[model samples]
Target: MLTLPSIYVLDICVFVFKNIDKFTRVEDTHNVNTRHKKRLCAPFSRTKTLSGSPYYMAVKIYNKLPNTFKTEKSPTLFQKKIKQYLIEKCFYSVKEYLEFCPK
Candidate 1:
């Protein structure tokens, strides 16, 4: 059975999905392993097939967030929750995260 906390978390999940586009933006960063190249982090390659952006990416990000952080809080909390979750998961502070770029 879903407890009170679980219910609240479900509500937050719904809110995040409802505001998916608002919270998630297309991030332009270096290609998978090529530091010299850059591209949008969407799955679709061609313009015609590209559905503005892919739903999977946003869903993927949301799913990675910890359940403890995903409370039925305000919309602004989404990004903050993600940051907190990441810090806990990776065991790093803001400065350390900024310095540790993937190779």
Candidate 2:
């Protein structure tokens, strides 16, 4: 059966957190860090598909926000420019996250 190995999940979380400035209020670095720690501390379980996984659930929740929410993917050049501007405004405050692996 196909499943997302824990390493891939950690990488995705790191990527998401790093680029989180592109998305509005969906998650902060602290929140993502906390969730990552939770996942690391929890026991692993097999799932039938990646879509049923926690990562997918988090993405789904983020996508469900009202249209007013600013996400990395915008429909137009103007919106993209706007998003970039917003991200630049706060990028300095963001910190890098270290990836963790299970033994």
Candidate 3:
């Protein structure tokens, strides 16, 4: 069952964002800097493997989203845009997706 890692990441991000009350937002915490105010705060993961958990990964990927995408208010539109962007860019790996620099 081959599938795109980016799509999995996208779905995770959307789910997390939709259920934002379950997660900590940077703005809701005092520890995070103001620059990260719009992002979600990832929980501390002591082990490298633990950092790969869906919750952690979702925060990581969501925080990496372009500001334009992050600011989108409509879930449907955001999902559509991200899906199209993912398909067009065709990221080969999670690392590649993380390191992406949109121009």
- List TM-scores for all candidates, in order: 0.32, 0.24, 0.83
CA RMSD, predictions in order: 13.3, 13.7, 3.1
TM-score for predicted model 3 compared with the true structure: 0.83
The most accurate candidate by TM-score is 3
Whole-model lDDT, model 2: 0.36
Candidate 1 versus the native: TM-score?
Answer: 0.32
Q: Which portions of model 3 miss their true places by more than 4 Å?
A: 1-3, 31-33, 101-103
Residue 14 in candidate 2, Cα distance off native in Å? 0.5
Worst 10 residues of 1 by lDDT: 35-44
lDDT of 3 by residue, 1-103 (tens): 2147877867976887588788888788786567768778889867898798877888888887778877788889888878877887787888888889442
By TM-score, highest first, what's the ranking? 3, 1, 2
Q: Judging by lDDT against the true structure, name the best candidate.
A: 3
Better of 2 and 3 by lDDT: 3
For model 1, give the RMSD to the true fold. 13.3
